[model samples]
Every structure is written in structure tokens, then in C-alpha cells.
Target: MLRTLLKSVSELSTKIDKLIFLCQRSAMGVIDRRTEEMDSDAIHFPLRTHEELRSLEAALDNKKYRDHFVARLRNLMCDDTRKSAKACLQYILSPELANIYTLHGTRSKFGISKYKFYSTVQSALCSHFRSASCPEKEILHAMATASQAFLHDARNKVHKRGWRSKERLASQALSDVTNIINDTSTST
Candidate 1:
């Protein structure tokens, strides 16, 4: 009787573990779907003009321009200038910055001209860093430099075929599992 009780408990535990695993997987799928939707919205944001597109492309392609801007940022000595540069660099390197780069290529569809983009970025940096001594132009230049470096890096990732995003990997896994299940069902 004890042996039978132990066997039943073992089976019950295995079933509970399987149930918990499935629940966790389902919750993760919901989270992944929501994240993918948000990313899609960002990627599809519209561009304001052809000039803006061209400007973004030029920045992404010009390695010399990007390097020069980065060099200027690195050379900044003023306390205010350093604070502004730090803010600009942090923004550029953030995952949220992906909204500025369209998935189509190095082109951006941020619905703003290059000048406006720089202005907006500078405003954002100033608000975050409160650098009263940094010249506005210097801050703008730092933002532009950081943006160019980010775009250049993104372009290189495309060229090198960077790792697939989590959403893509999850989708592929689901497809493979479906195929396997269908094959097994048909074979049996």
C-alpha cells in the first residue's frame, strides 16, 4: 500500500512540474509578443522628408565623419561639455535608440529633419544634464557625433548578419515544434 502511495505521489509531482513549466512558457510568450509589437510600432514611425532620409544615410555611410565627431566628443575638456557628451553618448547607446533607426536600413524615419533631430536631442541632453556652461552648438555636435557612431555600428551589424532577436528566435522555435508535431502525427 505504501509503495502504491509513493508511486502516485511521484506521478502527481511530475504532472505538477509539467503544468508549471507550461504556464511559465505561456506567460513568456505573451511578454515576447507585446515587446515585438512595440518594436514594430517604433520601426514603422514615418519620416518627414526625403532630405531627412538622405541625411541619415550619409551619416551612416561616412566613417570619417563619424570618427571626427567621436574625436571631438573625446576631446571635450569643459565640465559642462563633458556632462553633455556623457548624456548624448548614453542616449545613443541605449536600446531605446533603436527607434531612431529604421529596420529597412541605415535610414531613419524619425519624422524630423536632421537639424530638428539634433535640436531635439540637444534639448533632451540639456534637460537631463543641466549643463549651463556648455555651448548649445557643442551639445548639438556631440549628439550628432554619437548618433553617427551608433548608426555606423548598426550598419556594420547588418553587414555582419548579427544574431537574431529574441522574437525571431521564439517564432522560429514555435514553427519548428509545429512541424515536428505534424510530422509525428502523420507518421503514426
Candidate 2:
């Protein structure tokens, strides 16, 4: 009777383990769907000029723009780097991950470090693409370069537009003061 009870417990344990695994996978699927929705709303790159911004807006309005852009990026990558870079881009652009890093100001949350994140991305890439030639260092470098470029372009655009608007406001105020002075002197 004890041996039969032990066998039943083992089977139950295995079933519970399978249920937990399925739950985790379903949770990940939900997160991925949410991330895709957020990605649809957010622009990943900085627009340097008004024209560029308008162009991007137009492109986004078209539903196929994302696929076209991804295809173009993939075409730019060499064969060995393509799969890894694509996977890295997907991971980097995940809205949930971005929010965690941006809002928390740290990458150590949920016991995840940079290395672990990279490894996860690499493993996913290998499983999905059946290729592992691309190194984690290269993926890191690509992410860094893209992030820096986006920030630099965004800053430059903001500064230029900010100064232009400030100068225009100041000039308007000065003209208003001069007009007031001129009218008072003439009336007096």
C-alpha cells in the first residue's frame, strides 16, 4: 500500500510540473502580445527633422512599414549576423523590458543581469533560427550603437527646436516693449 501511494504521488508531481510549465509559457505569450501592441505605438528611433518625423508618421500609418523596415534591416546584415541581430532587436524593443529598465533605472530587476538577458536572447535565437554563430558581444555592441544614435539624434533635434522657439518668443516680447514705448512717447 505504501509503494502504491508513493507511485501515485510521483505521478501527481509530474502532472503539477507540467501544468506549471504550461502556465509559464502562456504567461510569456501574453507578455509578447502586449509588447507587440506597445511597439506599434512607440517609435523606436529619433526623428532628426520635421520632414523625417512626417515621413516616419506616414510610414507608420501604413501597416506594412514594420515588415518592410525589418526586411531592409535584415538585408543589411551579413548571413551570420542576421539571425542574432534580429533576435536581439526583438528583445531590445520589448516594451515590458524597456519600461522595467527605464522606470526602474536598473537592469538587475527580477534577478536578471545583462549577461543573463544576453544569454536568453542568444538561446532564443539559436532555437528559433538553428544558428549560433553570432556572439553575444556583437549583439551587445549593436544594441549599444543603436541606442546611442537614437539618443544623440533626439537630443540634437530637441535643442535646435527649443532654441529656435525661445528666440522667436524673445524677439516678439522685445518688439511688443518697443511698440509700447513708442506709443507712450508720441502721446506724451
Which parts of model 1 are misplaced by more than 4 Å?
A: 1-118, 124-134, 155-161, 182-188
lDDT of 1 by residue, 1-188 (tens): 99999999999999999997656534433113443221111211123334333333334344444444344434442345445544444433333344355422444354222443344445655554455566666666665665555555544654456645556689999999999999999999
Pairs in clash, predicted candidate 2 = none
| Per-residue accuracy of model 2 over 1-188 as CA lDDT, tens digit each | 99999999999999999997556534433213443321333334322333333333344344455444444444434444444454344433332233223211244532122333333433443433353664556655554554444334433544554534455679989999999999999999
| Candidate 1, poorest ten consecutive residues by summed lDDT | 36-45
Give the candidate number with the greatest lDDT. 1
Regions of candidate 2 where Cα sits further than 4 Å from its true position: 1-130, 160-188
lDDT of each: 0.48, 0.45
- CA error at residue 18 for candidate 1, angstroms: 50
The alpha-carbon lDDT assigned to residue 29 of candidate 2 equals 36
